[model samples]
Target chain A: MMNVWTLFIPELYCLLMAVVFFGLAMSARPNPRRDYFAALFMAGVGVVVALACVRLEGTLFFEAYRVDLFSQVFKVMLAMGFFLVVCLCTELNGIEERHHPEFYLFLTTCTLAMMMLVSSVELLTIYVALELSSYSLYILVPLRRGHGVDVEAGIKYLMVGACASAVMLFGLSYVFGVTHTTYLVEIIHVLPGVIGTPAAIVGLLLVLCGFFFKLAVFPFHFWAPDVYQGAANQVTAYIATASKVAAVAIIMRVVALSGGSSKYLVDMLVTLSIASMTLGNLVAIVQKDMKRLLAYSSISHAGYVLIGILSMSATGYASAIFYALAYLVMNLCCFLVVVKVSHDGSDLKIAQLAGLHRRAPLLAMALMLAVFGLAGIPPTIGFTGKFLVFAAAMEKGYVALVIIAMINATISLYYYILVVKAAYLMEPDEELPRLPVSIPTKVLTVALVTAMVVFGVAPSYLLEVARAAARMLM
Target chain B: MIVPYSHILMFAGILFAMGIFCAVARRNLIMMLIGVEIMLNAAGLAFVAAALRWQQLEGQVFVLFIFAIAAAEVSVGLALIVYAYRRTGSLDPETYNILRW
Candidate 1:
């Protein structure tokens, strides 16, 4: 008999951490420094706990929750991501001092919710978990100090998120009415017969909109640029990387419901992919703020990830997973630079990167690696990830898609290289002070850059792991 | 039966559309939140109707969860709106546009 306790170790750890943080934050005159360190320590423990749970396999909560290799892999990755974001953000200067511990409380809760989301196999459970994560993020967005932008970002994210969920719920009701079950496996069994029906197709597409919103796909991507620019740098980094990984995981799971039965679904995905890439890349070229630029970049990346998803094959799914994993490191590398260079917890512009090579050589190196990787330059993980995604689409005989993706890649290079040029070629102010980078950031930069190059050079191992995870859905 | 299932569904659909309209057209944050509440209630109504149509309890159980989640969403949402109002002294979203490209 598998005890429910065994299945919930990671969640329990996260909940405990959240409660401790909440208690500390509620105390009279909480010290931010102490709470910050405590939060970091808890995240480190979370990483260990999540890693330890990776091999446990069972079901709990009357089979609504599953513990399997697939969920475990994502849980471990999300925990590590949480740890990385906490480590990278040593200070909470952009946030009000009193709310610092509260921030960690929300962060832990969000991470916990995502872990639950990955394990949830029932529709209602998934919806509840997603809302938990969304509500936490909605609160976190507006907590930025001294900026009206934060409030705007919060309201926009909330309203849009609520609308998307409402649409998704209505769709779920249709699905439930048709299938008479909310369990994914049962729905998958029933979906094929009904999938050809117009109602079923509409419900499936509506269901995808919630995740599309989360991934910042076109038509649902309006929140990304605004929210990215408005939120604090650390918060932006979390959204850009970790939350994106969660979105990718959930998307893969949801799209798997089709089991490659419907041509209309493929067509829909293809159209969305093309639009996302073309619009995301074209709009990104004119962005002045670094965060906004990356926001558009992420949108385009979401398009590229869709290529693998649209392929509807195991290889395609694996490539998408690999791409998301690689994106986590590469995008964080970029935000790490942004966080360091901003210095005063304000928004950073493209021009601010001028003479970064002079101000901080290591930071400049990391930025160069990240941008080059993002541009799909060779001998970097971005190139490897994109190569696999494109190859997966090509294997499916999507020649036009491949060509369009290539064009978008080429178009993206101009803006990416522009950033690199600004950093390496432009001169610093005559009296500008040199940047001071802490030990943790230096270590993180080196680690991320090394991972970028190493993973690019030797992707077979990661590919194999990604294949196994993909196989679970198949 | 007191009402046909289609009639209940039509009523829910109209309520949902109106809720979406209010959410999109309104400038006030509190009004937008109310719109969301109305939309959620529409979902609950549909769930209840489905339960009666199927003579199954699962749909009713689902509605219970929906109520719980909608309450949670509203509580946090209202708190956030209050926080924003305190800081900005206004509820109009247009005035909060400090991060435009």
Candidate 2:
């Protein structure tokens, strides 16, 4: 009994954090400093709690939720993501000061929901958990100050998200009708057997749609650029990093349900992956707003991650997991620069990044490395992630797919270099004052940069952990 | 049990399509929300029919959960719609394209 309760500690801790923020939100006046410190402290503690529970394994809620290495590892990643995003909230200029507490509150709830989402093994539980996280984000997007665009983005996100979930639910009904079971454990046994049937195949594909929407896969990716540009930088960062990580975990789980048997499923996924890569990269080249560019880049990363998942092997799953973690770290580094550079909370234009090398040398360096990492340059975490994924696909004889992905990677380098050029070589028409870099941010930048390089250079430890986690899925 | 599972599924599928059509074709935000609600309820109808077909309680239970979630979704959706309305003074989605590329 005690052990079962221990498996839930991380989520419970996040709930407590949400409650604390909720209380703070109810206070008469909002003190941004107090809220920021409280959120940072609580989020830090949440990370510790998640890490402490990473080794505990059990089932809870009548086995609707499973706690295993896979779920636990994702929990730790989600916690870390929440903490890092909170660190960027030190200057929450994008949102109104009074809305600060609510911002932290929604972020906590969203993190908590994602933790539940990763652990849930029952279909109904997954739907509930996914919606919980989506709702939190839907609210958070519009909380930005002085922008009708935020509300517009929020509504679009809500509409599209609602439609996707509806399609997912419709699909779930078919899955239930066909399998007569909601438990993933049971579904896994039954689904692969009938996977050749139109009902089973269509149901499974439709189920993947909800997660694909979350991941910003090609057909479901229309909202990314606008939402990333309209929402506050911090909210966009949370969406880009933490939300994406959760989406990858759930999609992998759902895709694994096919047991790698359906040729049609593989073909469909392959098509989507290739399309996402091409469309995302080609469109990203013309983006002027930094966040919008990252949004399109995120679409392509989704494609890369899918290359790992569609391989449908333990190595594939492990590589996908590794890619997700690598993405989180490097993407955070980019957003950190975005947040700091756009201190006034306006959308950052690529041209505005001109002379960043002089304005804040450390940030410029961080942005360059992070952007290079994103472009899959050698000796960076992104490159290592792409290598692992492509290798996994190659092992599965996806030769053409891997070659196309490599071409996409090369095309991606063009835009990423443009960003670095803006930061390093392009001169500002008017010399701007140097950005004020705080001590803690400097430490964070150094830590993130080191992690990117060190992990990229030697990924053996993380790969082993990812492999262990992947084993649990099979 | 008298109604074939195929018939029920066909009915639910039509309803679902109708909902989707409303969501896509209607220019009004409130209508779009209604369309989503209709789609959800259509799914719920299928779940209930599925429950009857399988003679399992899980499907019916899932419908209950769906109802609760749909209610929650509507509350949030309406709040967002209201907020957008307050800001732009129009319920048309076309009017809310300030964030276009």
Candidate 3:
């Protein structure tokens, strides 16, 4: 019994943190500093808790939830993401001070739900956990203060999300009908043999639509740009980083069910991958809002991650996992600059970053490294990640797919360089005062830059761990 | 079993189609929410039929989850709709277009 409790430590700790924030929210006085400090402390402790349980392995809840390296690694990532997003909440001006505790509460719950999501091995459990996280975000999107567009973004997110889940549920019913079992382990044994049938392939593809919505893949990507632009900067950071990591984990799990036997599924994934990469890169070029540009770039990155997942090999899965970690760090680095530069919590236009080098040299340098990393330039973690993913695909005899992805990478570089130029070269029309750099934020920027380069140069250790985690899926 | 699993699936599929049509074709936010609810129920109906066809209790249990989640979705969806309605005084999704690409 004690060991069982240990298996649930990370999730239980997150729940406790949520309860604490709930109590804070119910208090009469609105204390932003107290709320911020409480959140920061709890989230930091949450990361430690997740890391502490990384080596423990057990099944809980009658085998519905599995605890293993894959889930634990993602839990650590989620906790780290929560902690970093809280660190950016120093101003919290995008939201009303009175709503600060509630914001933290929803974020904690979302993180908790994702923790559960990563551990769930049963279909019903997966559905419930996914819904729990999505609902929290639905409420969070509209919580931005004084933005009419936030509510609109919220409605669009809710509608598209509902439709996608509904489609996923219909597909789940079919999967249940065909396999006669709701356990993924059993389905993995049963699915590939029948994957050639129209019902099985259709059911599996429809099921993927739900996670595709979360990851902002092509057809389901309509909400990302609008929501990212409309929501508070911190909220966008959470959505862009942590939620995406969870989505990638689940997608890898679901795609693995096919067991690499079906040509139809591979063909379908290839088409979606190409479409997402091309469309995301092409549309991102014209975006003026920095967040929207990141949103489009995220859509394209989802395509790249899909390339790793669709390969259905252990190396492929490992590379995708590495890519997710790299994305979380680099994207957070970019958002850190955005949050610091837009200290007043308004939407940041690309042009607004002019003279950023003069205003805050550290932030500008961080931004440049992050953008280069996103563009997959050499000597950054993002480059190493993309290389691993493409190499995995190449080993699987997908020469054409890898070539197209390379073209997409080059196209993506154009916009990323455009962002770099705006930050370093362009002069502001009016001279602005040098932006104040808080000590903690400066420390964070330096740490992120170091991690990007260090991980890029020496990926063998992280790659080994990712390979171990991917082994669990097989 | 008596009705045949294929027929049940076909019926559920039609219901699901209607739900999708209502969700996409309707202009009012409330109608769109209702459409999603209908889609959930259709899936639930299919799950029940699947339970009988497979002679397993898992699919039946899954329908219960679907019902509960559908309720949760409706509550959240309605709350968001109500908030948006108050802010803009319009139920038309087109009116709330401040966030365009």
Candidate 4:
């Protein structure tokens, strides 16, 4: 029991925080302002607990959960992302009238579940944790009141999520049908003898489909833009940033577990990567809503990360992890601006960004930094991530794929720059809201933007850290 | 005589196809919920079939887990459906064009 205790301290903190915050919520008559602090405090405790786990590394609780540098780094990153999300969400004066308390509870619970997901080494553990994360989002989406888009978004997300989970379960059954083992290490040992079978490949592809849906890659990406545009802006940020990070982590873990590449899987992945990047960028060109644009951008980014995963080597996995970290910061920064500038909670349209420089100079500047970083421009972490991934692909002699990604990266720049131009170059039509945001949001935004630039310039530090973390996945 | 994996997969295939059709074709919100439930059961069937075929613990264990998650999903799905019906007065998704294509 002590082993389980140490393994799940962060989850315990989150569970306790939810109970306490519920008590606070029930007694305090829905103090939106106070509850925000409750979220921050819980997230802070979570991060500390996650860090403490870093020092104690071992397989615990019958090897269902593994605590190591790999899990530790991701858990801490997730906790911090949750903390920032909580801080950023505090100012959502808009959601106060709705079921806001329930919203915060599920948000915290979902983050806890995703943290568990990265640590789960057993197939059963991973399945349940994935569902835990999904259910929370199903509730959070419709909790947004006064908008039909919110309800619609919630339903769409649920339907697609359920289907994906089903596909994954079906695939899991196939794997079990063949291997008789769900322990990843054991499964890997057995796979070389059996994975060449057609049923095994079909199972693999089905499971990959489930993951691709979460990552929002091509053929499974139809739900992304609608869900992004229909949901509240902050909710969209959670889906695009934190959700993608978790999905990418799982992809890398599963890929590593394969030991080496299967020709079938590699060929399939390369084709998917090419399609995802091309379609994601080409469609993003016409998006009017900022959230929709970011949705497609994230899909393309997933494609780039997939290129690294396809490399099926240590450097490939490390670069993918590094790119995910870089994405978590740069993409969150982009959405932070969207949340900050659209204070009244109106979905930001490309046209509305006109004259942002005049309305809020500092925010516009932050937006520029984030967008440029996303476009993979130098002096931003996005460039560093893209460089490492492309180099890894080249190492694998995927020359055509690398060239395609470069062209797509260049194409992505145009749309991202369009947003910046709208912010700085266009003129406003009316007197904009001169909003004074709280300090927590300001701090969160600045932290992400700074991380983006610093990581871009001197990437070796984070790069080496990612490299070490990737080595542990096997 | 135990059920074969092929029979189970056939049933699952039929159920899955039916669920997709109902989810896509039905205008009633409750029908869509039923479709999702059917689809979920189909997935669970796959696990059960695989467990019997392989004589392994993992597949049946997966089925048990899916049942647990499916229960949770149904509750939430029903709640959202209720909310949507109360607001829209009908489950016809064609009317909810408030979302962009």
- Tell me each candidate's RMSD, in Å, in order: 1.5, 0.6, 0.7, 2.0
Per-residue CA lDDT of model 2 for A227-265, tens digit only, reads 999899999999999999999999999999989999999
Error at A418, model 4, angstroms: 0.5
* Predicted model 2 interface RMSD: 0.8
The C-alpha TM-scores of every prediction are 0.97, 0.99, 0.99, 0.95
Minimum summed lDDT over a 10-residue window in model 3 chain A is located at: A193-202
Q: What is the lDDT of residue B92 in candidate 2?
A: 94
- Pairs in clash, predicted candidate 2: none
List, for all models, the DockQ compared with the true complex: 0.63, 0.84, 0.89, 0.61
Clashing pairs in 4: none
Residue lDDT tens for model 3, A425-471: 99999999999999999999999999999999999999999999999
- Of 2 and 4, the candidate ahead on TM-score is 2
Instruction: State chain A's TM-score for model 4.
Output: 0.96
- Cα error, candidate 1, residue B62 (Å): 1.6
| Model 2: lDDT of residue A464 | 96
Best by DockQ: 3
A456 in model 2: Cα distance from truth in Å? 0.6
In candidate 2 chain A, what residue range of length 10 has the lowest lDDT sum?
A144-153
